[model samples]
Target: MGFLIGQTYRKMVGILAARFKEYDITTEQFSVLCRLAEQDGISQKEIAARTVKDQPTTARILDCLIRKGLVHKEMSAADRRSFLVYLTPLGRERLDVLLPLEKATLAEIFAGLDAEELARFRETHLQLHRQLDALHQQQEA
Candidate 1:
């Protein structure tokens, strides 16, 4: 089951990467961008938490985005220690381009599935995610 799910995720990522070649962004980077798009001005630590990424890895990704001029980080006014991350205009423009690629990829990936099957698949996926989350929390405890 793990192999099957991993292969499916890998293939989907491969397809999206190929489709968005001009962006020079990996799926991980795109994920960070999408998270920031939904919750802009969030702290790097918060981004890490929300993305289920470690602080160092998230920081490294944010550094690359900063270098690319796609994201900006500012010292948090409320927390003297933390920094807030937000997407720049360039990042938003890139998202505008990437969103269509994502939608088209989903359309292609689910081309044959009927609505009922798709709904069931989505529910099952969510259940799997929740179970995984619980497992992780147990390990942490």
Candidate 2:
């Protein structure tokens, strides 16, 4: 099951990456952008947490987004040492364009699954995530 899950994840990333090629964005970058779109002006640490990405990885992804003019980092007034990330106009426009494509891609991939099956799949995945989160917390403790 782990192997299957890994393969599915790889395939999903590959498909999304290919689709995003024209936009010059990676799957990881798109994820950060989506998180920012959901809530702009968030600290890098918060973005990392929301995206489930490590600090270094999130910083690198943010660097790329900044270079692409999709995002910009500003010093947090509340925390001088930290930076808040916000999506630029270009980033918002790109996300607007990609949102439909993302939905269409999911629809295509899950086309064979009926609504009930899709719900069940989603529920199972949510349960798995919760279990993993608990295990991670236990390890941390």
Candidate 3:
């Protein structure tokens, strides 16, 4: 089951990555963009937390996005050492273009499942995620 789950996750990401190829971004990068779209001007640490990525991984993604002119970083007023990340105007415009494409891609991917089945699938994944999160927290403690 774990293997199948991992396989399916990769397949899904692959499909999305292909769709995003012309935009010169990966699904991981898009995830960061989506996070910034929801809330801008947040610290890199906060972005990493919201995106469920480690600091270094998040920084690397930010670096790529920064290079692509999709996002920008500025020194935080409260902390000179830390930087706040924001979506540039180009970033927002790109995100706007991609949002509907993303929705369409997801709809096509889930076309086989009915609404109820999709709900159950989501619920099950949420349960598993919560369980894993709790286990991780326990390990950390």
RMSD of each: 1.0, 0.6, 0.9
Expressed as tens digits, the lDDT of each residue in 35-60 for candidate 2 is: 99899999989999999989999999
Per-residue lDDT of 1-141 in model 3, one digit per residue for the tens? 999999998999889899999999889899999999999999989999998999999999999999999999999999999999999999999999899989999999999999999999999999999999999999999
Give TM per candidate. 0.95, 0.98, 0.96
Candidate 3, 9: how far from true, in Å? 0.6
User: Which regions of candidate 2 fall more than 4 Å away from where they truly are?
Assistant: none
Residue pairs with backbone atoms closer than 3 Å in model 2 (clashes): none
Compute the lDDT of residue 95 as modeled in candidate 1. 94
> Which order, best to worst by lDDT?
3, 2, 1
TM-score ranking from best to worst? Answer: 2, 3, 1
Locate the minimum summed-lDDT window of 10 residues in model 1. 19-28
What would the per-residue lDDT of candidate 1 be over residues 75-138, giving only the tens digit for each residue? 9999999899999999999999998889989999999999999999999999988999999999
Cα lDDT, all candidates? 0.93, 0.93, 0.95
Please give the lDDT score for candidate 3: 0.95
